[model samples]
Each structure stands twice: as structure tokens, then as C-alpha cells.
Target: MLSFSRTRSPGRNTSPLAGGMDYLEPKRKSNVLGRLILIVSLTALCITMLKNAPSFTSPTSFSRSQEGVTHVLVTGGAGYIGSHAALRLLKDSYRVTIVDNLSRGNLGAVKVLQGLFPEAGRLQFIYADLGDAKAVILHIPKILLYEVDKIFSENAFDAVMHFAAVAYVGESTLDPLKYYHNITSNTLVVLEAVARHKVKKFIYSSTCATYGEPDKMPIVEVTPQVPINPYGKAKKMAEDMILDFSKNSDMAVMILRYFNVIGSDPEGRLGEAPKPELREHGRISGACFDAARGVIPGLQVKGTDYKTGDGTCVRDYIDVTDLVDAHVKALEKAKPRNVGIYNVGTGKGRSVKEFVEACKKATGVDIQVDFLPRRPGDYAEVYSDPAKILRDLNWSARFTNLQESLEVAWKWQKSHPHGYASS
Candidate 1:
């Protein structure tokens, strides 16, 4: 209107379109630089995520950082059998991660293992309860919270060794729900995690109780699983779940139905340390040690009128060492999409009277034995054939001598009279 833009300076654009272009050039360049900076930042973030993320391509696929090292997750690793199994895994140079709620497990056993395998990356422990169907949060340092899924997501576990369960037969009869939840429900949780994470190998720590009171002498793998008590029934249900899941998955399953597990670590590092309150419903080995140590007035034989040799219940006493060995062998021989059900025992039965005598010989104490009536859910006799495990996994019980097994355990008990407290 005023003709103020009529004169064109030497460095100024005379055309309106050219002037608009000149004004937008700096803005366009700034926008382009901003986009480039954002792209570079996003690229760095993606690279960082890829570096930290777990490699979950296949069942056997592990991160390049952990190449050639098989990582095993041992549940209930603070308990008797689980602790021993973890010790064996660590000794074999395999990376191990132990998860235990410590409900019936002793943290001392895990501590002992940590002491033995003090090297970094050799062993780690996480306190977690598998009974929780929801997110089982693990309270670990650096990591504020870790659900069961998070555990599977973060760690590339090649296999899972499930040993977590409420195993007291008498207690299971009294509180059936506890057994169902702890054994059956908890096993489902672990199985779900294993399946979801595509873990290849699975070694289940089952019990011979699942066989119930079989009419046969040495129960085999094909023997009917007619569980009498809740403990056995829950374990059987868990076995069914695992078998059913393995049908469609590439998981290599090994269900080890263990008989009477006895003894402790042969090197005196770990042993059975049942809680004082649980001693009433604990194993015969624990009771024998308690009686020898004068913790209990005398060892009360639960049943002495069964139709066995000594008029007492008969059981196959398998050493803890031998049992763990069988587990390792089973893990080694597992095949993808194949399930192996094995009965782990000595293929020999020992009565309460015989066991008491062996305990006395081991402890050098004439422990007073009070004969009592048969408790509820008590079996007359239960043993394992172990033929299938021997044939397939090439595993057989080496610690067959009952007294020797008890002696090795007794030495630990005498040294640590108060179990882990004596440490």
C-alpha cells in the first residue's frame, strides 16, 4: 500500500515467493537437524535395549555372554534335596540360580553352598514363593521387583529343576489344602513359567508317595498312580499337568519319583535341617538325629503293625547324594518332547526297626524307640524298581549301605547339633 518494499536491497529477495523461501530456510534446516538428533537418540536407545535384553530365540539359545554355560534354575533350593542338587550342579561347573521361599527350607543350606561356590556367576539365590498364582515378586538387590515371568524373561534358563513342595505325609492328611496349593498349584506355576520361557529340560522332584500303597513290591514307572494322601495326590496331579503340557511342547521332561531320601552332603557342607516345629511330621532320618541328640525324648516309631518283615512300614532309603546324582543324569539324558518317569531308590526296602538299628549304629547311641499305632495315610510298604532309570539314564543308587549313609549324616549332626544354628 505504501510501496515500502518497492526498492530491493542487494542481499534481499525482490519476489514475494523468494522472500518467503528465504524466511523458511533457517526453520527448515532447524527442523531437519532436530529430526536427525531424535533419530540418533532413538538409535542409541534401541541399541542399548538390544544389548540388555535376554536372548530367547530357542530352548537351548543362550546369550553370547554366557556361551557354553548351561544355566539351571533350582526351585526350593534351600531345602534338603534341592540344596544337594544345587551343590551338585555347581560342582559340575554349571551356572545355578536357586529360588526358595524358606517356608520349610533352611537358608543355612543355601549359605553353605554360597560359601563353597564363592566364585561369581557360579551361584545365586532368590527367595520366592511359587504357591502364589499371581506375580511371585522376588526381592533382590539392584532389581526392586521381579515376578516369576520377569525371572524367566531376564535370565535365560536352559532348564528348571523343581523341588519345591510340602512333603510331610501326616501333615498333608491334616491339612490337605496346604499340600494341594503348595505341591500341585505351585508346580503349575513353575510349569507355566517353564513352558512360556521355552525351557528345554525339566527335572521334577517327585515323591514315591504318588504310588500310594501299591500292591506290588518295587513300584515301576508304569505302575498306577493311585495316591492315598493329599501329598501324594497333589504330586500326582502335578505330574499329570506336566505330562499333558509336554505333549505339545518341545520340553524334555524327567519326573523323578523319589523314595525315602536320607543322609546329607558327604563333605559335611550341607544336611537335613528341618524346623523344630516340623520334626513331628518330618522324615525318619531327622527324627533319628533328634533322638540321638536328645532333642526329643525318644524316637516314636509311627507304625509297627504293618504287614512287613519287621511288623513295621517298609521304605526304600535313598541317600541324598545318590538322589541328586540321579537328577543330574536325568537332566543329561533328557530328550526334547519326550517325558521320562523314573522311580529313584535303592530297589531295597528297610523297615522302621531296621532303620532304627542302623541309626543307632551310626550315632553310637541306643536310641529309645517307642512303638506307636499306624498314623493316618500311612503305607505298609513303598519302594522303587529303579530299573527304568538304570536302563535309560544309566543311574543307580551308589550309597546302598544304610548304615554308611546314616553315618555320614550322623557325623554332620554331631558336629552341628543344632543343625544350621551350630554353624
Candidate 2:
């Protein structure tokens, strides 16, 4: 037999057990209802606050004025090209938010950028991967979706300079999936986020490899894209996707196809310091620096049998600063619903022997080299027309002279012997 409670509340007409149950049930219900109401009210309050808050990219009075200033989001801003771009943006007085996961980029580079601009609002860093949609959304504050006029008036981002990609030709050849996933898929995610935020302008760091083993010299923007390797294929895929996205949207895009990027910040504030694992010295200048500095035993010339002037591969090496200057010009000229494709290179080519001589002259030390047979996927010669970019953006590579560019790079390499390492 179950025992019933004899104690009861002071009720006029109710059984003792029933009265006891009635006393406790209302209190439990009230507690739950109160909690539910509190939760809903808090959520509403947060949403309201977020809706009314000032723009994340807005400037304080002491900071750079918000007038005519563009806030730029630079993905992969800790890597070599990305870092240089970020530095340029900061120097040009654009409010910049750098989003990098530091997976392939260097945290030390981010620190260098932060050190350059100790100001609070001019520069910001967000450590997040482009692939993680949720984390990226959480870390990079979205520009409130609004009309173009309102976006400019509200001082939100006017553009996105996307440089986040896994960009090694040899490595991509070995691990194609990783390149496709990081370069193509991650780029799609970035495009989606940019679209969601209503940022109209996009500057893509494309590569000239899209025109792999071209039929002729001086490849143009209209050159047929028949990429030879996975790296080039991934970049070409991204370019196609970006173009496809533009067909239906109001996004203005500038796709800068680079031949080769070399040199560093002329001011010596930034340079190429690839992650320790990459162990990448400068492409040719960097190799010379490493050899001269004795970082490696010596440099090796991969192939000398190509049908070039010196029987070595010839590439158009563009100074990184000049490349970024084009980006700045592109940002200014990018009109909504317009797409611009330009080859960001000097209309010239440098052979391996020529680059070696330039490096030697720049460093004042002869770099020992060993000639080897042609490596697979090696192109005989590749250069850019650059006439289209010159006409459109009024942009041209200023550091076309190989020796002058090498000299600037040599200075940077000599100073940063360990490549961001204290040694």
C-alpha cells in the first residue's frame, strides 16, 4: 500500500494529498516559464544591440577619418604576398582586417604587421581559416547587408582582397586534393562570405600558370587557359567560379594573373619568410641569397635544356610591391558588376643564368650552382603582355630590371638571415 501525505496547505475544499500536489506544481511551472521568458528576452536584446551597433570597420576620431576610406578584408594576410598586400593597405591608410589560420602563414609576419601599426582601428587581425564557415563567420564580423550607398555611408568594407591559397607547384603536383580543397573550395567559401556581407569589390591573387605551356610568348588575359598542373588547374577553377558568380551578382572582380612574384617591401619592413617547413628562399634571388649566406650548401639549377636563350627556363619575375600597387589601383577602379582580368607582370623574361648573374651582382658573391636535367612540368619560357593592364588600370611593373630587383631582395635576405627566426 502507498502512503499518502497527511499534511496539507490551508485550502477550504480539497483532499490532503491533492492539496499538497497543487501547492508544489504551480511553483515548478512558474520557475520554468520564468526561465523561458528570460532566455527569449536576452536573445532579443542581443539581436537588437547587434543591429544598432556601429560598424566594426568604423574609425575613431583620433584614428584615420572614415571619410573616403575603404575597409579591406585581406585573407591569408600572414603569408608572403598577402602580408605585403596588407602592409601596403595599411600604409595607404585603409582600415584592414587580416584573417589567417597561420597554418601555412607565419604568426611572426602578423606580429610584424601589428608592430608597424600600433594604432587600434587602422589594423586588425583575425586568426581563422577560410574553410571553417562557422569560425570565419564568428571571427570576421559581417558587414551589415545593405544597399551600396548605405554600405559606403556606414563605413563598412568596400572590398575584399583574397590571397588565401595553398600555392606550391611541386607540392600541388604531389598532393592535388589538398590544393583543390584549399584553393578552390576555400575560395568558394570566401566568395560566399563576401557576397553575404554585400562587399561589391573583390581582388583575387591569381597566377599566370593558368596559361600553362602557352603556344607563344607574352600571354594575355584572353589567352586560352590550359593549365598543366594541379596548382594551375585549381587556380583556374577558382577563376571560373568567380566569373560565374559575377554573371548573376553585382560583384566587381579583378583577377590578377601573376607570372612570378619576387622582391620584398623596399622599406625592408616586410620580406619573404615562408614557414620553416617550406624552407623556401627567394625563388631565384632567394636561392642566391641562401647560397651566398651559406644557408644551404649551394643552389641547383633544375633544368638547362629548354629552348631559351641560355637553354634554361625563362619566367617573368614581378616585384611584389609593384604587384600590390596594381591591387591598390584595382581597388580604386573596380566598378560594381564589372569584371577585370589582367596579367600582373612585366613584359619581359629572365633566364636562370641571367637571374644567377643578377643575384651575384646584387649580393657581391657568386652563388655556386649545379646544372641538372629538366624537371617534369617545366615550361621553356613564359612572359606576359601586360598591355591590357597598363591600358585599363594604368598599372605597370616598376621593378622590371632583374639586377635592381635582386639588389632590393638581397638586402632583405641578408638582414633576416634565419628568415624570421632569431638566429
Candidate 3:
């Protein structure tokens, strides 16, 4: 599966496009003519949105002294990483509101939220479109007002975590503008929404793709970021806007650059589940299903001849549990700087071949590995230097290696083979 981490195209993205859902890439790439169509489509979609709910100008206002429990709204909270993050926030006594359009989120994984907290409804599941700024406006309480124009000035928000983005490398390569607009423009919307609400804190889910292929071995936080793909461009754009917002608007922020996130929540609840990519065989029955759906050729093994020991691409594969822990720690470690960057990974790199061998051993099934040429926007060997996060936040990875990650991954995939659709 093409990792959703924003990867830029160095002119061409060889990875599968359009969420990599098989061969459906033609309609996604837009020309000047296609832009006209997209404008019309967006306009029509906006009209339909008006029918979904009443118009609301802004968010509701609370007294400056209101000391109620801090509310954390996580957009895209139903996503793979966001799901775990939301659960962690809830457990740590932060009230969470999850807003996802279900375009990429599973309703079953969402149900897990309710299961975790019978008052799951407290974690709002807003079905509003981010593309429709007015629709996004309607979801907020009528208190949040526009900051500059005072058009919608009655709003106030404590914190917002923006995780919603079109995170596909190959898709961005084919339709770079689509990725840029969807991610960068909508991110502008999200930040504007937060700024309007006078949000105190913001967390952004970012990726390592911004670094592209750096000249160094270990990528540090301060490494020069020159993302080669549109997905990376979009993230870099958002990151820049966020920093600008913090300077101009006093928004405290954390940009988490996630490495390869593997494993599922242990209870066999959630894992790396995309709607289209399903594996008909082995642990990635979900990925195999995508093969059936023709989104991907069965088990594509990208290049395996780097200077690494295994001769395959080596990457840091962090477990979901440890990944979630970093987020939790970030909440408490908010510095006066108000904006920080952290690379969240295990720091230990593993190869594709090694990963497959481990999976085969854990699941007790010999999986297929159709080696293919190196996909576009893929780094040969990249790992994290997690020293800063550990030293600063005292957050060390608990789940040490790939086996622990895969054990949970296999269990979760087995239980929810069809993903949230199973429930």
C-alpha cells in the first residue's frame, strides 16, 4: 500500500494514483478544462451541502473564565492515526470531538470510540465537508466570529488538531494540483477556522515526505525540507501557514512528522485499513481485497537493492501504541514557543523483506511479494532520530520492534477483515 504520508513528485509520481484505488486515475488529473469542471462540481456540492443543515455564521462563545474540561476537536479523528490519538486524548481526560466525512474513515472504527466511551456521542461525528467553508462554519457553534472582518466573531475554541488531508504520493504525482488544492487550500480553511475561533492550541499531523530524499543518513528535525512530490508540497505549505498563524495569531502548535505507522490497537479493533485496498490472502486480507478491486497489483514489493543489509528499502516502523503516546505527551509538553516539530518514530529501521518475513512468521502464512521497480517518491533508507522527543517529553517507544507491531496488526486485521464494514 502506498503510505499516505505526503510524498512529492519529482515531476512524475510512479506510485499508484487516486488513493491508489486500481486504475481509476484518468478522471483525477485535471487540466484547465478539468478545472472548469471541478469548479462546477464544487459549486454543485456546495449547494447540496446547504440542504444538510441550517446556515450558521460562526462558533459559540464561552466566557474567558469558563474552566470546564478542555475540549479537543480532532478533524479526521477517525483516520488510522487520528483514531488512536482521539482514544488517547479521551483516556487522558480531554473531551474530544471527531469530525470526519467518512470519505476515508470507517464507521466501524468510529463505533470503537463509542465502545470505549459509552458517551461516544460526546465525541462529535460531524458529517460536514471541509471544502465547503460555509458548511464547516455551520458545524461550529454560532459563537466563533471572523477574526479580521468580524463577520462571524462570536466563536471561541480551546484547541484543534488538523489531520484531514489527501495523503497519497502517487495520486499527487498524477494530479499535483488536486493534492495541493485539497491539502493546502483546505488547510488554510482549517487554520482560518481556528484563528477565527481564537483557538489556543493546534496540532498538525504531518509526514517525512517534506524532507524528500535528503543527503544525510538520519533525518533530523532541522534538515532542509525539499519535498519532491505535491503531497509533500501541500504539507510544507500547511506547516508554513501554521507557523505564520502562530506568529501572527498566537496559536500554539505541534507538527508531528509521522514515520511508517504499523500495528493495530491491541483489542483486534483497528489497524491499517483503507476502504479500497483489501488483501484477499494473509494478514492484509484488506490489501488483498484491493487487489481484487484492482486498485493495486497483488503485493507489490518496491526495490530491494539499497546499501542496507537486506538490500531493500529500510524505514522506521513505529507501533500505533507508541505513536499515540507521543501525541499524548505533546499535549502536556506544550512549550512557551507555541510551535514545535517532532519526528515520531521508533528510530529503528527495518527492511521491506524483513517486514514480510516477520509477517509470514507471525501470521503463519507465506505471503506473496511481487517485487516491482522502485516506486516514485520512495526513499531507499530512512529512519528517525527520536532523541529530541524522548529528551524533551520523556516519551520513549514502548513497543520496541516490528514483531510487536505485527502481532497487533495481524490480530486487528483478522478481527476486522472488512474493516469498519465488519461491524
Using lDDT as the measure, the top candidate is 1
Poorly placed runs, candidate 1 (over 4 Å): 1-65, 133-146
- In order of appearance, the predictions have TM-scores of 0.83, 0.82, 0.75
Off-target runs (Cα >4 Å) in candidate 3 are 1-68, 132-156, 277-298
Task: Flag clash pairs in model 1.
Answer: none
Q: After superposition, how far is residue 304 of candidate 1 from its true place, in Å?
A: 1.9
Question: Which candidate would rank higher by TM-score, 1 or 2?
Answer: 1
lDDT of 1: 0.87
lDDT of 3 by residue, 1-423 (tens): 676675555444456555643333444554656899989999999878875653333333221213666677787888887888888887786767677777776667678887877763245555544564454468953322232213213223467777877676766777788777668887887778776667778888899888887888688899899998788988999899888868866667889898877777776656667755423212333343334334455566768777779778888887878888887777666754477799988888888888777766666665666886876766787788899888888887888767667766777666665667766
lDDT of 1 by residue, 222-274 (tens): 88889899999999999999999988999899999999999988899998889
Better of 2 and 3 by lDDT: 2
Q: What is the per-residue lDDT of model 2 for residues 161-181, given as tens digits with 9 covering 90 to 100?
A: 999998877777778888898
lDDT comparison, 1 vs 3, better candidate: 1
- What is candidate 3's CA lDDT for residue 213? 76
